[model samples]
Target: MDAKTIYAQSSDIKSRTYLEYRKDMKKKAIAELEILVWLKSKLSTLYPKQKIKVSKSSGDAFLWFLRKGGVTREPDYHAMIDDKDFDIEFQYADKIDLKYFDFAISKIAKKNKKTGKREPHQDRKILYILKNNHSFAFFNPEWVLKNGKIGFVDAWRKDAYRIPRNKFIKILESDPTLKSVIEMIDVKNYILNFQHDPIGINKEKLSFLLQQIIDEQKIIKIIPNDLDSFFKVCFILDNLNKAPQNINLWLVYLLSFISNKNTTEDLSKIIYCVDFLYSKTELKYNELKSLVNKVKECFKLLKSFEQKDGSFKSSVNLSPIDETRNAVFSINLLEDLTQDLIFYYKTKEFNPITKIYQNLNFIHNTYNLIKNLSMHYYIS
Candidate 1:
C-alpha cells in the first residue's frame, strides 16, 4: 500500500499530533510577569532600567517601544533599556541551543601559525557581541549549565542517565516553559515533536528500505538460541524498561547482546542460533565484516532518508510516543560506533575529502542535535 494512502487513512493521527501542539503554544509562551521578575532581579543587581520590554518573534509588544522607533529583531529573548539593546537567550528552552555548544566546545581553538594570533571561534564571536560597548548576559541555558553534554538521548548516550537527577532543576525554575516540560518528562508525557510539521522522507523508497531493515532484523535477530540466555537477556531488558511497549528498548536489548559478542572471530555461531538466510551469527568474522559493510552502505541510505528537519516520516511501531525519537537513537548508535568508522577509514575505500568530512561530522551532528530538540532530550 502507498504510504500516503496509509497516512491519509488516519485523520486522527495528524490531528492528535498537531492539535496538542496548538494547545501547548498558549501554555508554552513565556510568562510576562515571570520574565519581568527575573529581569527586575538582575536589573537591580547590574543594569537598571526605567522599564523593560520582553521581545518576541514578531515586533516587541511594548506600545511605547514601537512608538520609540524600535524595529523587530531575531533575538530569542531580548531587552531594551536606556535606549540600548541587550539581546539575550534565556536558557529557558527544552533542547540546549546549538549556539551554546558553539560557545562551550570551542573553549580553546586552533591558532593560525602564520598570523601568530589566536583564532576566533563562533562562541567567541557571540561573546564579542555581548561584550561590545553595551553588554548583555547570555542567560545561560540548561545545556550550557551542564557544560556541553548530551541530554536524555538513550542508555548509550552519557547524558541520558545523568540528567534525571535533581541537581539540574534550578536552571529551569525561572521559565515556566522549561519547568512545565520537565514536569512532563517526569510523568513521561513530554511531547517533543507534537508542535512541529512532519519532515517527509521519500515515502516509496523509505517504505521499501524500511521493510528491508525489518527483514534484516529478523534474519540477523539478536536473541540468543539458548532458553537460559534468552531469559537472562530478558531479565536485564525488563529491568531497564522505562516506557510501555517501547521498541527503542528492544533495539537497546539487541545492541547489548551484540556488544557482548564482539570477541567472536571464527565462523562461530556467536552466542546464538543460526538465521538460515544469513547462515551465521552477526558476530562471526566474515559475517560481521559483510554486515558492517552492509551497515556502512545503509548509513548513506539512512542519511538520504533523513528529512531536512532531521526526522524520517515513517514509523516501525504504533506506540503512543513518537517513534522518530527512537529513529534518532538508532542514528546515534550507528554514528557512535567508532570501530566501524576506524575500519572504514583504514580500508582506504573513501576519498580524502570523505574521510575528513566523516571525521568532522561527529562535532557537526552533536551541535545540530543541540539546536533541534525533536530527537534530543531535555535534562531537567
Candidate 2:
C-alpha cells in the first residue's frame, strides 16, 4: 500500500464518478440559436415552398444522416418549407464537440462483425451549415472524406459568411484573411478560436502536466479506454488557453494511439531517453519522423487486439503479447523521436516554459533506476 498505489486507486474512483456524470448529460436541446442564425438567413432563396414546419431535435431520416456520419448530436431543426427539406447542425468548438469533425466524414460502422448484417438505415448528409461560436462555417462531406483532414478555417471566425455550394473555394475568394488562417492552421489553435491564452506549450507547462501525472501515479492506473493523466493535463491547460501551440498538442496526439497500465511511466522516462539518443546521433527531425511512423504501426497492431473485455488478446496472425510492454516500447520509440521537437524554442526565447523543463532531472534518474522493473514483466 504505497503512496503511488493509493493515489492510483482514488484517481480511478474519481474517474468512474466523472464518467458517470458524462453519460448522464446528453444533448437534449438543439443549438437552435446558432442554427437559426444561418438557416433563417437562407430561407428566401433555398426553400421557396409555402409550407413551413419546424420541429425539435429528432434523430430521424436525413436527420439521422448526421448520425451515420458519426454526429450524435440531434440537429437543431428538421424542417419542411414549401416541400423543400433540409437539416441544419450547429457546433461550438472548444465546447460540446471535441470530435465534432468526425461526424462530417464517414458513415458509422456499416456492418456488425459477428452478424455481418447492415445497420439501420440513416440519412446521408452532404452539406452541413455550422457555427463556430459567433461566426459560421460550411462542411462538405465529400471533400472531407476525400482529403481525410479538416482545415481550421473551414469553420469561420473573423470572416464573412456565405452559403456557397463550393465552400472551400467560396471561402478562399470571400475572405483572404480566413484563407491565410487556414493555410497557417495546425493541430493546436485550429477551428476553435479559444477565448483565453493563459498558457501555451513550453517546457514548464509540460513539466507541470508531467509532474501531475507522476505525482498522482496515473501511469499505474490507466484503463484500456481512458486517457493518460499527462495527456489529460494537456487538455485541461489547452481548454484554458484560446490559442494553444503544437508542442503539447502534438505530444498527446502521437502518444494517445497506444495505451497501457505503464503508459505514463514509460512516456515520462522515454521523453528524456529519446533526448539522449538524439544527442548521440543528432539525426534530422524529418528522419526522426520516419522512425516515429514505425512506432505508430506497432501501436496500431497492439491496439487492434483490445477486446470487449479490457484485456489484450491474440489475433489470428498476431501473438498475444502483454499490452503494457508493447505500450512502453511504443512510448520509448515516440520519446526518442520527440525529444528535440519539444525543446525547439529556447528557454530564454520563451519565458516560463524553460522553468517547467528545469528541475526535472530526477525523472531521467528514476527511469534509469526502475528500467529493470520492466524485466519482471518480461520474465513472467
Candidate 3:
C-alpha cells in the first residue's frame, strides 16, 4: 500500500506512522543490500583464486510485511565457492538465539511446486552474518541437531538447542577454506569507521534523564505523544547495572500511560519498561503489590486481543507478525515476572505461557497444510 494509505490504516498506534515504519524498513533494506554488495566485492577481492560468488537469493523476505503478510519468511542469499552451495543469512541481533535460526531453516526448506522436490534440505551449508558485530558463523539445523542440547530460550519462549557460541566459531575456524572466509569477513574495524553512533542518551546524561522522568511533578506534564522521550530515558535505565532508586514513582508514571486509547505499540513499550524495571531490583511490600497488579491488569487486556489460534489482534489488520511479535514479547515478560512464588497466587491463571507454544504449533500446522496441499496437487 501507499504511504498515506498505510498511515491512515495505522493511525491507532503510537506516534509512529506506517509510512515512517515503511521508511525504516526501506532504510534497513538498502543498508542490507549495501552490505551484501560490499561483502560480495570484498570476498571477490580477497580470494581471486577461489571461485567465490555471492548472489542474491530469492528466499530473502526483506519486506514481506508490506506485501500480503500472513506467514513469516526467512531471509537468505546464496553463495557458491568452488561450486559448493551455501545459504547465507545476514541479520541484526545482539546475541545468537538458535530457535529462530532453526525456524528460519525450516521455512527455507520448501517443496518445488511442479517437481515435488524438497529444496535446500536441512543438510545444506548455512552461514550467518551477525550484523551487530559484523561477525560470521557456521550454523545449520543439521549442526544444531548433532551438537547442541535442548533448553528453553526465554526470548522465543520455546526450547532451542543450548549450543555454545564457541562451537559455532570452532566450525567456522576448523575448516581451512571456511577459516579463510572468516578471516576475510572480519570487517569490524573497517566497517566501524562508516557506522553511525547509536541514537540514545549517553551514559553521562543518564542520571539527569532519570531524574527528569521519575520527577513526580514534571513527569505528569509529559503528554502521551511525548512518550518517545520517556522511552529514551527507559532505554538508558534498562542498560544500567544498578537499579534506579524511587522506582515506585517511575512505575506510577508508566501505569498512568496505560489507557484504552493506547495502541499495541504503546502497550508493548510499557510492558517492556515494566519488565525492565522488575528485572533490575527486588521489590517488596507495596512496590511488589503494585508491580504484580499492573502485570495482572496488562495480562487481562492482552487476553482480550488473543485469537483462538494464539495470534493477537492487530489494529491495522495488515499483518499478524506486527502485533503477534509485540504480544509475544509482552507475554514472555509477563511469564518471566510471574515465575516467582509470591506472584503465583495472584497470576496462577496466566502461568506457563501456553499461547507461545500454541502460536508455534499454529505456524507449523499452517506450513504442513501448505506442504501437503502442494504435494497432493503435484501428485494429481
Candidate 4:
C-alpha cells in the first residue's frame, strides 16, 4: 500500500473507517505469512541435504513434546550433546527438553543408559534440526563442532567462566560445517535478549568484535537482512528502554554499522533509534523533541489496519510472546500520548484542528475497553 493511501485511510477519524482498516490489516498479515512460508519452502528445497529438521507445530508443540517426555517446567538441565556417539543416559526420555538443552549440556556429561555412567564420545559433529524456520542444537562448554570437525570450545562469559571467543569466531568465519550451529547460537543468545537487554553488550566492544569477525568472512550470514531485520533488532533494542542503561553507545554503533542508506527505507528504526537517544536523561529537551517529531512523522507514515470491531492488529502471525509484547507496546505508546496531551493542556496550547485532546480521550477509552475485554476472555 502507498503512504498516501494509508495516511488518507488512517485520517478518516470515523469508527467505520477504523474497523475497515483493522480488517485490511489482518488480511495483509495473512498474506505476509503465506509469502514467508513459500520463501522458506524454496530455501529448504535448495538445501535438501541439510540436517535441519522442520516441524509444522505451533509454539505450543515443542513445549507439549517436552512435557509429554516428562521434562520439568523449570529450567534445570545443565548439560547437552548433539553428537550421535555421545549417548547421554536419562531417566525419562531419549530426547532432551529443547528449551533447557543448552543448560543441560553445560552441566552434565553424556552417560550410558544401562550403566548410568558417563561415556566418552566424539566431541565434534553436533546435529541440529529446524522447527518453523528456527534452529536448535546442543553444545558443551569444553567442546564444539565446527564444519563437521571436533574442536575445543572457545567463548567468554561475564564472570569467571572462560570460553573460546577467538576460536569460535574463527570457526564461524571459515567453517561452513559449523555455520548453522554458530548462527543458531547467535540467534538464541542475541534474539532472546532483545526484550530484556538489547544493549547488554558494550557497543564499541561488540562493534569491534563483530567487525573483526566480518572481516574474516568471505560471506556475511545475518538473517532477515531488510526492513524486517530492523524491526526485529529495534524491537529487541527497545526492550532496554525501562532501565538505568544508556543504550546510546549501542545505538550509535548499530546506526554506524547499518549505515544511513539502508536505514532510510525503514524509518521505524530511525524513530526507535531516536527514541532511544532522546530517552537518555542527559539529552537536552530540544534535541529530544526533534527526535520525537521524527518519530511522529514516522508514525504518520505507518499503515494502520482495523478490524470490523474497531480493534487493530499490529502484527501478523504473531507468536504468543509477540502478541503480548505488541499489546504492551501499544498501551505504552498510548500512555505516552496521554502524557503529552496533559502537558499541552497544562500549557494552554489549544488546537482544535489538530484534535490532540479529542484523540487522546478516544485512545484512553478504546484502551480501557480493550483491556476490560481481554480480562473477560481470561476470566471466562
Full ranking by TM-score: 3, 2, 1, 4
Which has the higher TM-score value, candidate number 2 or candidate number 4?
A: 2
Cα RMSD (Å) per model?
A: 21.2, 22.4, 20.9, 22.6
TM-scores, one per candidate:
0.24, 0.26, 0.35, 0.24
Q: Which candidate comes out best when scored by lDDT?
A: 3
State the lDDT of candidate 1 residue by residue for 123-233, as single tens digits: 221211111112223333334424444344432343321233233333232333234323323222122233122222212323333322112223223544443344233
Candidate closest to the true structure, highest TM-score: 3
> What is the lDDT of every predicted structure here?
0.31, 0.33, 0.48, 0.31
Candidate 3 per-residue lDDT, tens place, 1-380, comes to 11111111111112323223433443344344545655576567546878887755542213212421232344446777787766665544344543343334243355679998545455345545554344555455556556665566776687654556656545432223333333323322222211111112133343333332233233323322345555544554344322345665666667777666665666777876776555455556677667667777777677777766645675874345445556655654455455432333343333432121222324433333334544565697
Comparing 3 with 4 on TM-score, the higher-scoring candidate is 3
Q: Which ten residues in a row have the lowest lDDT in candidate 2?
A: 190-199
Candidate 4 residues lying further than 4 Å off, grouped into runs, are 1-274, 281-290, 298-308, 313-328, 334-380
Candidate number with the higher TM-score (1 or 2): 2
Clash count, predicted structure 3: 0
The segments of candidate 3 whose C-alpha lies over 4 angstroms from its true place after superposition are 1-226, 240-242, 317-319, 341-380
Give me candidate 1's TM-score against the actual structure.
0.24
